[model samples]
Target: MHALVVDSDAAESSFLSAELQRHGFDAQECVTGAEALEIHDKFDLLLLDLRLPDIDGLEVCRAVRATSDIPLIAFAAGDHGLDRVLCLQAGADDCLAKPYGLRELIARIEAVLRRSGPARTAPRPATDPLARGSLCIDPLTREVRLNGRLVHLTRKEFDLLHRLAADPHTVHSRARLMTDLWGYPAGYVPDARASRTIDTHVSALRAKLGAPDWVLTVRGVGFRFGRA
Candidate 1:
């Protein structure tokens, strides 16, 4: 895999590039945000640092996202919560705080790439709606119907439900859900805040569906689509 490393710090960039190369990535290094934008299409993924010479990294993230859905990881030094959220909101696929371990960085990279990569198993066709008993979800139209009645949900709520219903038997952890839905890596957001966010959304979803058991909580674990 080819990865573009965007950082103004020479030593940091060199370390990241070398490490990525050791892990089988063809790493390309660029020192400025402008350079990154100019060569973004040449790589399979992006490793961006928030501090840059010409333009801010968040701007770079927005620019790249406006054009392509390339896998992006923002590695920056700042308050973990705020920086992580900002990076995600700006369109990065993952955000890692500075002074992060190389192993963790690699793991995050692999995880993001895995999610962005094509599925290994054949997925349900996009045009086909997903149905489980009284619940129905149309991915193409982003529509959900419960018991033959239309249900209104925000984007995040719809996405959360779709993920759970997609794998009804799997137990999704709160951390996993946060990463999948919010783009923040597991543990990046405080446990309490993340759990609350998920719970609030689940509650809204349950109320809208008028079926409290539609989504079952795994207690301390996470949530799943219950069998009707």
Candidate 2:
């Protein structure tokens, strides 16, 4: 995979580029968001720093997302919740706080790529709609309905729900879900982040479906479809 690293800090850019290279990615470095925008089409993923010389990384992310769904991971010095949320809201697939470990960065990159890769690009299989109680999911149409009413869901949200609903009796571990949903190996993603990601999606799914009990949480274990 090829990655575009946009950061003005020479040392940080070099470090990120080298790490990406070591992980079998062809790394390209750019000091400004403008440069990143201009050449983003050439790369598979973008490693964007929030602080850029020309344009803010968030703007760059929005601009790129307007035309492309290419995977993007934003890096910033602040590790605050709002910072992370803003990055995600601005079209970033993931966010990394500065001083992050290289392993974590690599894991995030791979995870984002897996979601946007060719594996997910193929046409979905034509299967009969899955019905459990009032919820229904049509795999072929990628549509979900709750109590016969259409329910809108993000791509990741639907994928997560489908995975659990596909095997309602099995309680899927967060680590396992992380691997299946985001392609992050068990040890590659931090436990807290992985849990948060799953929890957030589950919460969104429950809210959208208006059926809180549709997806049951197994406390410290993980989550499963159906009632407790």
Of candidate 2, the 10-residue stretch with the lowest lDDT total is 117-126
Q: Can you write out model 2's per-residue Cα lDDT over 1-228, one digit (the tens) per residue?
A: 888899999998998899888889899999998889899987788889999878978899888865555688999786788888888877788998887988888887777777653243333444888887778889889999878889887666888788788788999887767766665644544465456556777887888777788889998778899652
What TM-score does structure 2 among the candidates reach? 0.55
Backbone clash count, each prediction separately = 0, 0
* Cα-based lDDT at residue 172, candidate 2: 84
lDDT of 1 by residue, 89-197 (tens): 7878789888899999999998887766434442443567898997899989989987888887766688788888888899988877776675664455436645665
Q: What is each predicted model's overall lDDT from 0 to 1?
A: 0.82, 0.79
TM-score of each: 0.55, 0.55
Query: Which TM-score value belongs to model 1?
Result: 0.55
Question: Model 1 — which ten-residue stretch has the worst lDDT?
Answer: 117-126
